[model samples]
Target: MSLIDLSKHVALGIDIGGTNTKFGVVNHRGEVLEKGNLRTDEYEKVEDFIDALYEKVHPLIEKFGKEKNFDGIGVGAPNGNYYKGTIEQAPNLPWKGVVPFGEMMTAKFGMPCTVTNDANAAAFGEMLFGAARGMKDFIMITLGTGVGSGIVASGKLIYGHDGFAGELGHTIVKPGGRKHWSTGSEGSLEAYASATGIAITAKKMRAEFAESMLNQYPEEEINSKTVHECALKGDPIAIEVFRYTGQKLGEALANFVMFSSPEAILLFGGVIKAGDFILKPAKLHMERNLLPIFRNKVKLVFSELDEADAAILGASALVWEK
Candidate 1:
């Protein structure tokens, strides 16, 4: 066995998505020095995926490896646990059962490893290198395919007893509304405030209002990005779509603020790129729903993270934490 250096200032970050696995080597300054990706769906077994990952990532690890200067690896995945370093029965992943993910990566790479839910990793990235820098108490909300959250209190990310805490996305926002396809849960925030939720709403709006500019696009084409583009073009129906989405998101956030009393709620992900078209209504609704004490206190802001680097940076940030 060859000796390894454990004192490097740079860390390896890996963000495992359902479709792709993004990996990178990053320094403490939040800069990614080397990066690459692989199609996750290509590997049927988790072990195969890990082997492919190790094969692909090892060259960078060796090239960037400096004597006693390289930090360990960090990973972010759906339903990942920091304590166990395992990926639980994630609905989106190819694996069917709990996989000892972090341990596998550590052994393959020969270094320390930490794993956490992607949302939690995003919060870490925000705290270490993005908007939440220097702040202790805040919540990072990811409004993507599904709503995801990471709560920070007293400057620490809350992991709860089972390491599955901070699932604000599944909280009931509408008591009897749409059913979540995966969990069979009705009216959850994830069903109302996510990009999928927006697409669903767009369909309903298209049906009710014939004048919708969305009518020009096919059903499959009516996604969040299209809606945002139409809204920017002064399309009334598209504008209303964002309005409704923002209202629900805002109300849910208002409740979140009352419970956690966070200083700010940082919004991340592609949907927020709609900018004030979504944020204005969200901010208005959030403040309106907030109690007297919390009304004017919590700040609603977009993330400062670079879309390209955020995932890797967030995952890498965990190495520093560990």
Candidate 2:
């Protein structure tokens, strides 16, 4: 074991995703000095997961501490609650319910630890160092398997009454329409706006257009990326799907803007890579739906932060701020 120094100002950032858990050492300037990832499926139990995390991260901390001063640790995960310092009912992880994640990490590393929902963390990362930097009020939306959001109003992350306030994806956009049997819901924003949701919508549209180029891909293997590629190649069906998804998102965003009156709306995640296919239509719809006071007032933008680094930065910002 190497002798560790305590004078360094680096903080550890950890982002736990459905497929992977990423960790990094970052400075106050948001420069990531070291980073790594672990497969989330490798562990069967939460304890096993934590043990593996410690095994991988402890060495980095020791190494960095030997060469520079280091601070604490910050974490971001699905269903994470900052107030409880726990992750409750995360859809991706195998853990059954709430786990004292922050306390467990602190106990293992002997450092201060904090945690927040992945979306909230990303929002904070964006506000502190990414696209939303310098903006006081904004909404950050992550459009992945599901639509996740972080609401910042008056320069603060709104945790609501129970730390579950920013579930923009679950908001109902269409009542008594497009029912999802899994959750017993009808026409949720996520059902149409997320990557999986868009893929489902694209598949349905593909059935109506027998001449669509998307037929090149098997029906069982269609994905958002495939649809985007086809749309970029001028496939009408693919284009329509993008337009529809964006329209739904835009309408939902218009409602959010009315309530929050945010300065900007920042979009992140893989699905947004469709670029103009999604953004242009979303902007048009949002503008069309907005009230006279909000029309043309709020700016819609993309995340400037590196996609791979966002979660880590967000997680690390929690402890770094301390």
Candidate 3:
């Protein structure tokens, strides 16, 4: 990729998630020229998974090559390591251990391949093509199935010494608080701020409030999406749940801001689509929690990228990273 003229060459971006693997051929402007997805859970072996992915992605590479030169490949996956190009002990994936993901993809595609965790990929995408396009210093927090983060400072993504720098989700906001099932920890931000966390919060509210509108539906039906719908419809229970969740998230962001003093904190993913239901509380709480010196100095905002193209574009943007 170093030898290739990036201005004239397009890149392949692949985002491998727990349920599906999405791939896209994208130009330098962040436009996705071609895109597709494969079911990720169907493959039991990592090798077979790579093979299937290559089969689906290669045709697009070939077709697009006729119009533009293919530079390289970029990948974003759970627990992906940018320095090592490996996926390390991802809890949800069927594949186990530290798999040499980048090398395998490079071999199959006959090009350079870069790998990073999904949040970092999204952060890079935002920097290159979305809201943070001109900003060098910011934190990108993803509020989805699980909370994730990517830290940027001085115009570079901070990978830390171990290449797993931004695990803001695992940071404990409350000591000895609610237990996170996967990490088995107490009061992790992921335990209180993620979509999964919101569901947990909803459950707790249902137990405490006998007349909750959430009680009108089955317990399993009271997910984040439904909670948002309920909130929009003036459901007291749902609004309270979001308020609590936003308090946890806002406090966490204030702590992060103290450490990095970022220009902005960008929120991404489905849960953020709740808009003011989530943002208003989060912004208010974040400012309140900040120190007097830092008060109201940082911007808290939602991502500008199209959710459907963001992951793929972010992965592809890795190729352009210095």
Candidate 4:
């Protein structure tokens, strides 16, 4: 009889996005051995998606000496429930209703699986290998197409009873304010803090300033990226869009600071690429809103993980966590 080699351990990490499903083989040290992606929207049925995933992934597992050398599979998906091992009511995904995603993965891959919402997975990754490392309490806020958040307190994620906790983005920051595009919720932080929100702000604000650089692009071409470009060129309207977005974000952060009193708030995703244009305003407003005791106590910073690989690394961190 031969003993298993524990030193060569690895895990399969999968990040399921609305457009693509990225998968990777990751070692304990957070290095991605290899990675690939497939179109997520192509499959209409959950069963077909799982089968396609198996067909594509099985060979990679075999290349790493099959399942014996692997720890397990870790997955991050929209609305994934760690406790229930399901994905329930994810609006962007083709699958409607509750999907037994973790169970299906385990059945197809012949391995144990751990699943969590994409935001939570990113938080776990931050805890294990990114900026939040060595910090027991912190919050991870992803400012992307839509705002997403994960809260960690007392060294653990706050899953609440329903496993749907830590949805800071949906919290209302203003009464009778901007309406969310999909959720239809008015005054939610996501309405003003996401990349979508930034674009919307730019579009509306640009009309008043006829000479604004934003007027150069047609309304359809006006997005967060173009706004950022205009801001780089010292356009006042474009800069104001980021300032307004940051004010909303900072106000929300103030509320978050009071609720959990985290050591830091780590910002991640494309929206943060604007750098100081957004960050300085956010920091200023956050401090202004905070109480004297809570002021200057919480650190606001960017995540240390590489954006391109953060999702994969985050999902892989789940396996190590378990």
Please give the lDDT score for candidate 2: 0.87
Backbone atom clashes (below 3 Å) for every candidate: 4, 5, 0, 0
For residues 1-322, could you state the per-residue lDDT of candidate 4 as single tens digits? Answer: 9975655889888888888898889887788898988889999999999999888888889999664488789888889998998999988899999999999889888899988988888888888788999888999999988888888899898889999998888999998999989999999998988988888899899988999999999989888899999999999999999999999999999999999999999999889999988999999999999999899999999999864366677778788777
Q: Taking the tens digit of each residue's C-alpha lDDT, what string does model 2 give over 83-199? A: 888999987787868899989988888988888898988898898889998988999999988889999998888889888779998888888867753466899898999888988
Q: Model 3 off-target regions past 4 Å? A: 1-7
Per-candidate Cα RMSD to the true structure, in Å, reads 3.1, 3.5, 2.1, 2.0
lDDT score of residue 232 within candidate 1: 88
Ten-residue region with minimum lDDT total, candidate 2: 1-10
Q: How close is candidate 2 to the true structure, as a TM-score?
A: 0.95
Total residue pair clashes for candidate 4: 0
Error of 1 at 148 (Å): 1.3
lDDT of 3 by residue, 1-322 (tens): 3585556689998888899888889988898877889999999999999999988888888888886788889888889999999999998789999999999888877989999998888888888888999999999998989898888999899999999999999999999989998999999999999999999999999889888788888888988988888888898999999999998998899899999999999998878977887888888888999899999789888899855466678888888773
Clashing pairs in 3: none
